[model samples]
Target: MFGDMMGMMSKLKEAQAKVEETKKRLDTVLVDEKSSDDLLKITLTANRTIKSIDIDDELLQDKEQLEDYLILTLNKALEKATNINEAELAAAAKDGMPNIPGMNF
Candidate 1:
């Protein structure tokens, strides 16, 4: 029983390491979002870090419109990034997890 516990603990540690490595890898995965009319574009990493933003000249003419574009586009980009980040991390963790009887995640 003690040996089993130790093995499980080791597996859990390996799983955690994989998840952290995946997180670092995700920083290199880019997600792009653009407005419906293409007036604004946003780029972010799977880790949800903003990389860049491109705005059309027309958007610069109106501050409120620019803000609205930013809000909508950024939200869309973040949603995509969140999805990618979660899926990758979950896969990494699952791959390293030890199968203990009666335990399901």
Candidate 2:
């Protein structure tokens, strides 16, 4: 019985390791956001790192508004990326711990 318990524990540990690895990989995925007017584009990774930004030349004519637009676009992009990352992590956690009773996994 003790050996059986030990074996089960080992398998659980292995599952945990796999889940962590999968989460890490998903965390590196990227998301892109474009402004409604298509004047600005921003790309961010699931870890909230900005990958790149593209701005339309026509939109650059208004310097003050350009800054605001860029800021808003980046903020929205970051928010989206964060949400995606969280969902993926939550899913992985649930899948990894599904057998735990009474747990919201």
Candidate 3:
């Protein structure tokens, strides 16, 4: 029983380490997304933090249009970041545990 507990503790430690590593990598993962009209662009990290945004000069003249495009672009960037985050987490979980039957991770 002690051996089993030790093994479980070791796996937990390894999982924690992998989670930390994933967070570090997420900080460096930048995802860029653009509006359909190509008038707006946004860059965000996999952790869903906005980094930068670019808007066409013409759009600056129309506040409503600019706001709409900005919203669209931001949503796309955030969604992409979410997908990347999920993938990274899955990879980290896999790295932490090689094969455990019936276990999703």
RMSD of each: 0.8, 2.8, 1.7
Candidate 3 lDDT by residue in tens digits, 1-105: 688778877887898799889988998999999988888888889999999888899899999989989887898899899999999988897788634558875
lDDT, each prediction: 0.96, 0.78, 0.87
Q: Quote each prediction's TM-score.
A: 0.95, 0.72, 0.88
TM-score, model 2 to reference: 0.72
Candidate 1 lDDT at 95 equals 96
Q: For residue 93, give model 1's deviation from the true position in Å.
A: 1.0
Q: Give the runs in model 2 whose Cα sits over 4 Å from its true position.
A: 1-16
> Which residue pairs clash in candidate 2?
none
Clashing residue pairs for model 3: none
Candidate 2: residue 47 lDDT (0-100)? 76
Which numbered prediction scores highest in lDDT against the true structure?
1
**lDDT tens readout by residue for model 2, 62-99:** 99989998889988988887788888766665554525
The best candidate in terms of TM-score? 1
Off by over 4 Å in 1: none
